[model samples]
Target chain A: MKSDFYEFFCPVKVISGRQALSNLPHEMDQLNVKRALVVTDKGVAGAGLIRYVEDAFQGSACSIGHIFDETPPDSSNVVVNQVAELFKQKNCDCFVAVGGGSCIDTAKGANIVVTEQTDDLMKFRGAERLKKAMKPLLVVPTTAGTGSEVTLVAVISNVQAGVKMAFTSDRLYPNVAILDPKMTMTMPPKITAATGMDALTHAVEAYYCLQKNPISDSLAITAIKLAMGNLVKCVENGKDEDARLAMANSSLIAGIAFSNSMVGVVHALAHATGGVCHVPHGVANAILLPFGMENNLAKRAGEIGELAQYLCGREIPGDDRAKAEAAIQAVRDINKKLNQMSGLPNRLRDAGVTEDKLEAIAKVAVNDGALIYNPEEVTYEEALEILRRAF
Target chain B: MSQSSNKNDSRGLDSGGLAAAGASAASIYPKAKEPLGMNRLFSLSYPVKRGIARVALLALGAGFEYLSRHCDKLKEEISGWEEGRIFALSILSQGPSVTMKKENGAIRCVGEDLKNAEIVFYFKNIDSALMLFAGFIGAHTASAQHRTIVHGDIGIAMEALRAMNIVQSYLYPGLVLKKTFKRAPKMSFGEKILKAKLMLVLLPGIAAAARR
Candidate 1:
């Protein structure tokens, strides 16, 4: 279904290929920046992905000014302030985020702090609240799932308040996104599978969500086909650079799709599950996607059914409800395959969520901003029911 | 140069003729100095729409106050809000706004003042505001259409939206509710009576707020 009115914008310059990382310095030079701050986690740094980024800048005029590799799994306001201080102390002119969602979000948050010249990030926590243009940010996503590289939103946790602060604006998009297969080659099978499922969920939810439009719908279909074709191959053989690149492209495409169309109940529940039970976001998303689809089956059966061909790699011959159910079953089958191959959890219990936390998770889920774009209205009781079923 | 030819070249190009042409063009395509009929219509409708939105906001605020006292669901929804936390709904760019504050375990309409608001839900224009107020669209639809923006914590905004949904369920008729809500709310018989009572009080409440 098409929306009556919609707005879509993505200005990120994407450089993809085997040697996409080598274009980083030239990309920075195009932005008239000479110094860059590299934001990443210790995990990515330990995985030796930073070496590729360093190699990209070895002989270039643009240089890495500082490397802040202390980004936590959940980037926070304190961490953003710390990164901004480092960027200023080193006289950096740009940011090069080199990990997954957390690193990219940290760089985005830090960009807001540096550009707005504010140590307090809470004041700028909602949509289009930042009045200043952010510093140039170049992203090299080491994990393909989060797609923070192209998204115009960032979530930074406020440690003191124990609340996640979400900042959204067109300015949060990275100036460049480099998709190098070498960057993701080190991901283990389970992480790869989980992240791949996360990308799938993004594509599926974006296709059927309330904000869906023609452009996003096209991008979402492409993303779903790419993910369905390449995710398992990359998981089974981590060295398949072709499959890895395809999955990377899938994630990036899905990111663009969902960024415009927005996500729905799956992301709301996944965010809640991750916040309350400390579940990994990709795992939470993977576990909750089918249930979320089932929940929306009443309102969005035709749209969901349209996705059956892309998800199952074959046309499903049935009514909308039957095809929608088949599409959902395809998701469960993929989860089962991934679980057998890489032990990616397909149930909430296996993803470290206890039954006792379902109520708390539901409470948080109903308050998530993503719920506004959901096809079906998810009440507190409905959210609890979904959580209970997923568990 | 021939004086007669120069005079011919200048024909119909004198200052008076130029001014007449400009006026003719302005009548067809109005410039900054001349307001078009469409612009005049919009300008006239702007204040009327704003007035309607103002009253609707006041009525909504009043509904929140009333429902918080009587509606169990609304009371439960607002129980988690911090004391004195203020939120507002306004049209962008110097438009009329209504601020509501959480106090004494209930919501209070603080009139059109936006000061001390911890969060604000801004309609991008008066038309969007009127659409929502007139039950032509729901909050989620307006949000999904990007016709609205929030300036504070999104979580708190979502909570406020839930409360607003409850108020709208009572304020709007079942037919409008069915069209606007993602899923039309199912109200019990007592709740239907409460909705009727709310409708009875809403007019007087709007009149009272208009005086303020």
Candidate 2:
């Protein structure tokens, strides 16, 4: 057996496999919950996962206080406050967060208010800023992607400032994350494709962050290979359990990598797109991943080529330059396949980005946090040029 | 924070004639068109999953065509984060080498085109461009795994990273090398595995990694 490592950690108790949701009651009992709020989007509720969630807590000591089912795609600050208000009115003790990142993130924010009486998300913006622990939080992912259930970060869009209010706190980590393959098997192709790409982005970013240690490399590398092998298959046929399992595993693995090492330009760019364009986070990441990768080549030649060979599932020998070139080709080919196979967009411009505004984007991109971590040093003009080339 | 924008700053931009550094060319922004850009720098490692480049390129082309002003918004947010209090973090340090910039009255980040915006941009060729793009995207995915094994860790048995480090000795010796890492220390497979394992543990919500 290949030697394996396990440095990554999230406290969430995952009840996976066929009847994972059935374990919800048992898992909550272990956590010792009495009154838990079920947090989810309307769509998820419509899908009837709510009954299963209720059933999970049926025989348990826990009772449902209320289900704040008003979650949206880009959860705004308004959503957090509203949900928190519902939690208050219902007097819920703990939270059972279901749905994608949005619903789960909204639950996280609401828990902060219910536990601490703090609605000022702006005060807790940076990493490690939260002072007190929130009410017990349990996250159940309805989709294979959006590792939000495990991440310490919760992105809340503030409509007034037109900025994404990124709330990062160790306490933000869910007490439990229930990742069940059956839960994600029902995602439509579009959501599956976008979310799967998001997983790919996470693993890739973690492997290469400046803070990356030996530990992150192995997990990131493995996650990348998994995404490469499974994303397409899952997108092609949503019910394919193997593909679904692979994506779920990769998502879990990648979540560990980037949560520690951090991400660069693709995220920085995607964050911006999510704000102005109303594009989903994963979709934005998928669109910009290639452009960001291409820009990092010269500066990161050694890293790029080595990664390519691994992705190609081969042993690369001889000239580093040749190996690097092969890796680049591999990436291009993979992207071509994913794009052709899945209906995910391949360009920001095609997603309704205007040509005249390219210069401004370049200027803004130069300052995105991820850009700093990008292997190459990129300037505003250079960033603009990248956008231009993409256009 | 008061930097002299004089023509002769110590960073070497002032050493040569402005035209030689490609500053005189007509650029989108008059202040930015001709300033010498920074040199491209690389990270330590990456994932080279098949066909990522072509995929990213196609995605980039499509996104650029459709996304428009939202792309501009993305750029602006990055500027806000960068120009305000860019965090210059060191793996060994308690306080980041630099701090995350906050939007403060004292730190004026005017939404204006920069005369000398970047310290780096890699356009050596299209192939290089594609690799960089693919890697950047790939890194995003990898970061999630790294966090799990490192600082962000909350649970799990005997951190996976520690096990990975131990396994490195029993595993295959690395055979790939691009531009020999500039000044990186040679870590044993054990150490690398340990680090990778830890990274995966701490950062579980996100995947992949990238370095400046």
Candidate 2: deviation at residue A5, Å? 18
Candidate 1 ranges with C-alpha deviation above 4 Å: B1-44
- Per residue, candidate 2 scores C-alpha lDDT tens digits across A1-391 of 0001123445665555666777776666777777778888889888888878887776677788998888988788888889888877887778888899888888887776666677766555544546786788887888866778778878777677566666666788888777777778778887888888888777766655444545666778888888888888988888888888888878877876776566776776676566556668777777776677676666555556667756677877767666767765665566667677766777777667787766656545544555535555455666767777766
lDDT of 1 by residue, B3-108 (tens): 7446646785887657766787655334323212434334557778777777888899888878888899999989988899999999998888888899999988
Backbone atom clashes (below 3 Å) for every candidate: 0, 176
Model 2 ranges with Cα > 4 A deviation = A1-9, B1-212
Collision pairs in model 1: none
What fraction of the native interface does candidate 2 get right in terms of contacts?
A: 0.02
> Each model's C-alpha lDDT?
0.91, 0.58
lDDT of 1 at B134: 75
Candidate topping TM-score: 1
Per-residue CA lDDT of model 1 for A198-249, tens digit only, reads 9999999999998888789899999999999999999999999999999999
DockQ of each: 0.31, 0.02
